[model samples]
Target: MGKTLVIDLEDVILEGDILDVGEKNFGIIYNISKEAEDELSLDYVSSDTKIELKERKYDACTFFFDLNKIWTSIEKEKLIKEISSYLKEFGEIFIWDINKERGKVFNNKIKVILPNEKIKEFTFRNLNVLLSSNIEEIKKILEKYFEIEETKAWEDVFFIKGKKIGTKVNEEEKIKYEGTDYSN
Candidate 1:
């Protein structure tokens, strides 16, 4: 079977109403917010793109841009659990987000021109979380279900790639994060 991949729709694929490199690749595009769902369509996206609404199984998933835009630490743990339920036993997950503190230093150098005011407004609110978010927390969440394969940072973006590591323990045990406080 072909590997299934899921991608965030906003900053990950569409940058200020313009399709980024991700739109050219095929996968199940997921819009966590209603506003994003309403704004995206095949009119602008590649014909290979398919918007996924229902919870479905996937082999690999990618979260580009920001995790804070999708969920909080506590909520993120829950989301990890939800993703685990649908992921194949040996599935992999990839995450890429702006390393807030580092990104700030080079923010001015990276400029993205929005197509219009509406798009500009949406992009601003959508990326607000990256300003104060710690990508390490997201890495911790993924560690519960997958083994860290690789982690690197380029300029301001931090990337993490993990492969599902099977354990003989119970599901709860497998998803538990020791010494990590997810209350935030």
Candidate 2:
């Protein structure tokens, strides 16, 4: 199968030129954003990524965030559940935050306050994922769905990589990730 990569439009790609690498290596590129459909066209006109403006499916997806965007425990759980539904099985999901350590603590606090049903439905058990935060409670939630492959902290960001327990199984489900593009 050809490699596919999905990126959030508001991500650091425009600033860091990360799209250059994905364009070179992946066969399909999907840009997801809350912006009007063509809003990002100008930004990518000169890039080699051959941006697929009409497609939404992808084998991998990336999200960059600040903990402040998630104000409540329920919001956090909803965000996770929404994103998980959009992912392909064995798909790689990357969540990055500059203050990831603080995010770890925030995640744990929210987990304690949220309901078990909310947590269970949104669990990330079907994909290969990397999270910038590393609170033990957050790790426990991820471990329920993925096999912990690695854990490390670098340049002030804590990260964990986990591979899904089985191969792709839920790709047939139709679920669109909601919320403002930059925020989700």
Candidate 3:
């Protein structure tokens, strides 16, 4: 990937697909805000050296960000392989919260928090993208490189909504919350 503008779900839209499938606890909680920068203070990832913030250290470290790394009914290792190849040009890559304990280092290694409730796994990467402001501007900037394909999380939620079973919400739920619908 050449240039990418990563977005936090709560920052731009509702919650992002990444957090939905992530480990939850350590993934990175986001709140609704129209301001420039909020609590988490995340930023976007791009191809160029135009560093927006001074905290981004391009050292020999892996990048970890929320980018839809859930393995519910389908296998995500293949997706990770594809994305990993794309990230090789940039550097080592880690996604979501493969580990836990926010700033807590373990065994002298930068553990990647997976945000999972049951098990906390560690990876050798940190997050490269951390955008949390100006969605329209970020979208325009990202479209140049990443051919973002908008896909729903799980399809089984469509038939099992508000009932007793599936908590999964389909496009209809998204429409109800977004106040607008898109051509799916």
Best by lDDT: 1
Better of 1 and 2 by lDDT: 1
Predicted structure 3: clash tally:
21
Q: Which TM-score value belongs to model 3?
A: 0.19
lDDT for model 2 comes to 0.34
The pairs that clash in candidate 2 are: none
lDDT of 3 by residue, 56-174 (tens): 33211112333322322123334333333332222322222222123432122222221222223323333323312122322232233233333212211100001011113543575
Ranking by lDDT: 1, 2, 3
State TM-scores per candidate: 0.49, 0.36, 0.19
- The number of clashing residue pairs in model 2 is 0
Could you say which candidate leads in TM-score? Answer: 1
lDDT of 1 by residue, 20-70 (tens): 213321222233222444654322222353343123445565554535454
- lDDT score at residue 155, model 2, on the 0-100 scale: 43
Q: How many backbone clashes does candidate 1 have?
A: 0
